[model samples]
Target: MIAVVTVLLAFPLGYLLRSHLAANVAYAIAYLWAFTFQTLYLTLSMLGGDDSAFSKNEFPISYGLVAAGIFGIGFGLVALGHRVGSRRTTRQAVS
Candidate 1:
């Protein structure tokens, strides 16, 4: 749930950063940022004594899914940034 938000946040950041950096780099930075946030989130949650976020039997699976999802989201955002950036370039070339 919270992890999903981080992934979603990466999309816009990747899009916005595309103009200043390569798509891959932008996505990587966004993903790393999100990952850092997630780490902090988990650490805080544990320290704060909230164990509800972790399921007894499903913890490992859930964590893996979230990590993979974040990676995929980063790649997707880079593709999206490239698509959008290419459109402008294509239009300018035609003009």
Candidate 2:
């Protein structure tokens, strides 16, 4: 799925971005951005006469929310990974 791939890709970038921002804030911002884009894209697709993605229904809205959540989780994983990585380095240096 595209959502999975996006998160997988974003995780590394999120880790790198942590150098500039705290991980929680960074992930929240990233999720909000991704959600905004997804909403816009879905709207445009509907306006362009694409009927496969939207309707007068709540399912699409929920799906979009889930997608954004997934991306946030992926971004958060980077922060988690950073913590694990730092611990390993310290242990290696000690032994």
Candidate 3:
């Protein structure tokens, strides 16, 4: 649920901000760092205070999926940046 929303939101935002290559790269790095921190936090939480059979089983999978989502966002942003930059170059050449 949350994972899906994060991916969907991140993709378009990344795309829209893709024109600024440095900024986009920084943003993607920041996102990756943040997600890593989130994984650590989740792991700590699960280890410190957890119960039942399901908690141990589900945590790793959920975390991996979220990481995948973040990667997808980063890739989408890079691709969008390339597309936007190329288009701008083409238009400038024509003019």
Candidate 4:
């Protein structure tokens, strides 16, 4: 699924960004940005007269939220990876 791919792709990017930036808040904001873009893309894609994705009663906004949640999982993994990475670097430096 697209969501799975997105999450898998986001995880490494989030980890790299966090490692380079040295700012946790920046990493959060960077990953959170995908939500706005995803929502906009889905809504606009729907409004452009494409009805292939959903039924008459369904909406794109909901799907975007779900996608964003998937990305959040990836970013959480990034946080974990960053923590582990930093610890390793610190240990090496101490020795």
Candidate 5:
């Protein structure tokens, strides 16, 4: 169910932003990160750790960190892709 939604959302977004390699890479990274976090969250939640106070506090903090990391990775990928694409475009334009 979640996987279906993720794919549906990710594909067109990736395609529409494809013209800018940076945007494509950003979308991919963000989707991948979100997928990873969701998988981890579901797995942990299914294991039944929610009954504890420690679990409640830890989970939210962990989730926040995961989200931040995902955003950072996505931005990093976008920046790298943008640099590479710019170089390629410049080279082609020169030639």
Candidate 6:
């Protein structure tokens, strides 16, 4: 649910910012920003000792996998939006 919201938010921003930066750069920015936030939240949850969901998992590896998956899907959408925005601008220029 959270991932969906993040992607939804990123896509439009990426589309709107298409002219401001390269697609890859925007994707990298989005990826790093999201990954950092996730890492920080996990670290704080563990340090705060508030019964972290990450700690309760029998398979600790799942956390990394889930984060990767979320980033993969989320950032892919960012790139897709960038591409769409680029195409839209190109079409407008052509006409």
On TM-score, the leading prediction is 1
Error of 3 at 84 (Å): 1.5
Instruction: Supply the TM-score for candidate 1.
Output: 0.63
lDDT of 1 by residue, 47-94 (tens): 677776664344456776878776876677657766776677789899
Residue-by-residue lDDT tens digits, candidate 3, 1-95: 33443455444554455355654565566666677776666667778875431276555565577567767766675567557766767788999
Model 2: per-residue Cα lDDT over 1-95, one tens digit each:
44645555455644454252565565566556766776788789888878777774445766766775786566667666566656666788999
- Between candidates 4 and 6, the one scoring higher on TM-score is 6
Write candidate 4's Cα lDDT for 1-88 as tens digits.
Answer: 5454445554465445535444345545555575566556655777787666554566557666766677667567667767766776
- Which residue pairs of candidate 6 clash? none
In candidate 3, the residue pairs with backbone N, CA or C atoms under 3 Å apart (3 or more residues apart, or in different chains) clash, namely none
The reply for model 1, stretches above 4 Å from the true place, is 1-21, 55-59
lDDT of 6 by residue, 1-95 (tens): 34755565668766878553554466566667766776787778876875566664455687778867876676677777778888899999999
Q: Which digits, one per residue and each the tens of the lDDT, describe model 5 over residues 1-95?
A: 23443445444443344366646665766576666777676668756865442354345576556555755555555555556656766788999
Span of ten consecutive residues with least summed lDDT in model 6 = 18-27
Top candidate (lDDT): 6
Scored by Cα lDDT, where does model 6 land? 0.69
Query: In model 2, which range of ten residues has the least summed lDDT?
Result: 12-21
Candidate 5 stretches greater than 4 Å from native: 1-54, 57-59
TM-scores of all candidate predictions against the true structure: 0.63, 0.60, 0.53, 0.57, 0.49, 0.62
lDDT of 2 at 18: 29
The whole-model lDDT of each prediction reads 0.64, 0.63, 0.60, 0.60, 0.56, 0.69
* Candidate 5 to truth, TM: 0.49
